[model samples]
Target: MLHPRITRVALGASVCVALAACGGGGGGSSTAVGGNSPPATSNAQITGKAIDGYLSGATVCFDNGQGACDLSQPTTTTDANGNYTLKVSGDATGKQIDVLVTPTTVDRSNPSGAPFTTTFTLSAIVSGATQNVTPLTTMVVAQMNAGKSQDQATQAVQNLVGSSVDPGADYIANGDSNTTGVAADMVGHLEALYGNGPVSWTLVQATMNAYAAVGNVEGVQQSDVNTQLSNMALSQPIAATAALADSLYAVDGDLIQESSTGAVVSPGLSPVRENWTLSGSTLSITQEVQSSGAWSAASPVGSYDGWFSGNFIQNTAGLGAMLMKTDGTWTNWFPNSQLHPAYALSSVGNNLVGTDPNTGDAITASYRTIDVSGQPLSTALQIDYRNPVRGSMSGTFPTGTTAYLASTQHANDQLMLTESGIGTAQSGSWSASYSPGTGVYWSSLSDPTQTLTSVQQVVGTQIQVDGPCLLLHIEAGGVAQIVESGASGCNYANEPISFPVAGSWSVYPRNPNVITISLPKSVGGATVPITDTIKNTINAGGSLVVALVNGVLLSGYMLPASSVSTVQQFPATVTDTIAAAMRAAATNIGETQNP
Candidate 1:
């Protein structure tokens, strides 16, 4: 079915507090922390600087759509260097996070001494402490306001600009002089387009949104805005579809059965949505995720590193330990670390969901830990179990804060067992999932049909599979026939592809519910006498459902080729994720212009 089309993620930086955040463009609101009159000590505070050359003496406050900061909310004025430490009082629910930078006559920049004339609006997706405002982030927020998720919007713009420019980050704090210079130049360029220093954020945002409508940029990287935004005739801004830049070219399925477990990941760490048809018979997992550079952080400014060991998640990147409690609540007690200003977490069902403790946006992190007590690591040998077994884990979380927890799950818990001590690395995914099926052969249960109708009738027939970038035909006594389609676009048909595996298939004598899929092994060109039997495999919908490791981590099902006339039976795209994925695939690779 259809799921939210996603990109890879790393380091999530957020906290869960009671308050929420919004953005604005006026300076009449906040009770300025260090300016105007020192009122009372505020309950909450938000700090930031206006980076249009650092507007000093500028009035900064949470804008309320009313053209000014809400009188009910707090307000402040930037010091000599354009820095404002504002306060939040009362039940800070729905406090306009849209920061408004109103430059009065006295408000001016330092070196250049440029005078402020108009209001600059910016969407402040800020959390606990810092909420820096700039024209670049306004572009990101414009995309967010148009309906794309934060990650999608952030990355889309990043693709538009250079990979080094992050629209959602604080360049000043991150010390990104590269992007900081880009921000400085952006204001002058936008003002040139719209005319004047009193440039409204709306003008800047509309300009960005207009460019985003162009669809794809394939490989258009313009570090300078004048050269980039100048080339295209931007259309009237419209809502952008949520598609990743890489997903447009290819969408292929990979079968990577590893030779060893070098570094520790979840045992069976599959990066796709999986389904289990025959739990104890054979484990099948067909995952459909964006085909990209090994699922890593989508953020240009940061990357993520940690392991799901029992309950605690240790941030190998020095963020320290995040303890996920049994009481359903989570804690980010990184003692003596000022890395993340605000952070909080809690679990909902199998998912660990939370957001900008201040913004209240919902992101996710989830996984299933399989139970393999009575199971064999493979059909070759049975391990005498006395220790804890681990399974593979996968899910989505904010690039800044969300993390996965894997004690176990209710269904589809086919284990991706990680063996250690001796020859313990059988599930590594360092190969490719291309046309030749070079590394490992993968099977799928992508569109399962509870097929157990009659095993005898389906045995000698040709069967086809359609899942991820997977497409193939199953032959009873020969090599498999597979289809040739790229992995990123996922534009394959619903039919048998190609391949020829010469092997004799038969039902297991010991367990009537299982069967032996004697996968052929060739040391050179000659066939070797050995069989790799996957666990818990069975006949469902009259087709063999099996899984592959080292070669792949998918659980595919077989459908007789004759019945493939109905496209829906073996769908080209899952119902839920297709609309979004296809819409994105239609656009070119870049964010500024459609291909």
Candidate 2:
């Protein structure tokens, strides 16, 4: 939740299970949509399961929101096992089916075993093959209702929430709690919000409706709702995963050694072996107790059995969606921060499939291996999480650290020729570096070879190999101190997993225009250091933004530094700082909006 104004409500307070038992469970056949009177195949039925923690005693029906699901339609109540076989016919074959799970359902998944009131979920069937209604599918339905094609809607929701379980299959029945666990959290939160009586019916309905509208109910952002659910994933204790997230976990047998910030001191040791003491947070640190296979699971809260993205694993489900390749290794990391909720994922057919964030076409991570025989071999990381970008990542931020620079936009130039007369007066230190025929040339101080040599046109900031993850915006003629700071718009496709904040980040001082991030990539057995430098002011908000630029990195260190050469100075007088802050807040027109 952006602002966690949570009000914990009591569950199962009354023995009363007066759910929406009022809704009839008798709709019995298939109905065609767009009006095609095709012959019906009476024996043709759709099979699936409904599990908000194995929701039994609930009614499932088929409807297009246009006609009533009476005896002519297919409907059935969930079995004691939460399974349902909606009676269908050939007419339902080509048509899109909105499998509706009415709120009159009760959740046995939560310890409370309460019933949902006034809350119903809808999942759109793209093909008869996908005939299930999970929370992820519910979001897909909302997106579809908002006008996206079912495929588009499904990808959109997957991108946002992360992970792709066969929404059509029952995770519970399949014995996959990694996914079912996430589903339970999703269901549990909705149930908690729905509460147990007539008074909460409207609240529950409004949350679903508002969520469908891509709006918030009860001060919750849709992302917040996702976070609330995922945060619940890490709300429990998983010390091993917890160490990977930010601190160190020294289990009796396993030894993971690291400082407070999530830098992995151990390469690949099951059950970390460190006598760790977290520097800043109150996270539970345990010593290693090494044992081989057959280990029991920690709380799913922040536990992720994947590769590291940053110094921490920002979003477990988000990474789960990547379907990244893993080495049969598994662990979880809990970011002490609440904004970045915890999640987990498992392989789905090993086919890493997802909608391209920009084009919406089926695409896999570009960083994954290419073909040797004109096609990627199964061993080369195809669908089902084979992308290198889909691996687990650790982060390097202090515990209890709240804010970092966020970029809704930025101008990470491929080449620069004195942006907005940045080289106008004195031209500072970089001006002395190199002067070309047309524009000035400055090579990154970190690497003398990679020169900023090109026209000043803004590089597209949309997930290109070397670009800031957030939207990119830069002022045209003037310089500003802080870039927009707060993490919201790192389009869902930033798992390293190409997702945002999932990017490595660290806030050294209060809010400096310069946000230094340590994104460690092991190449040829050594770590590659990539750096990004914004101008001279910290983001207005204390929020951290994960700025990512692919290799041969630029320490834009002193480049943007010149922008503040004449404007902002450290140990700045309080009056000067306030003046600069006011200037930073001032609205400027025509700033570079390099999308």
Candidate whose TM-score is highest: 2
Give each model's clash number. Answer: 94, 77
Candidate that scores best on lDDT = 1
Taking the tens digit of each residue's C-alpha lDDT, what string does model 2 give over 104-158?
A: 5555554544334323443333345335556555544434433456566545544
Error of 1 at 531 (Å): 65
Off by over 4 Å in 2: 1-44, 64-74, 94-104, 108-112, 160-164, 193-595
TM-score between model 2 and native: 0.32
lDDT of 1 by residue, 1-595 (tens): 0001101011011100000111112233321111112233244776766654455655566656532455666778777665778887643322335445444423232333343323455444443355555555565555655556657776766654556465546555676655554454334333223222233333344345534442211111111111122121211211111111011111111111122112222233222222211122122222232333123211211111122110111112222322222222223322212222232334433333344332233333233111112111110011101001101101111122211111112121111111110011112232122111222221222112223433222233332222234333344653343333355766434322123334445543322322333322211010111111110011111123332222322222222212100000011232123223322322322222111
TM per candidate: 0.29, 0.32
Cα lDDT, model 2, residue 322: 14
Q: Model 1: what TM-score?
A: 0.29
Candidate 2: C-alpha lDDT: 0.29
RMSD of each: 24.8, 23.5
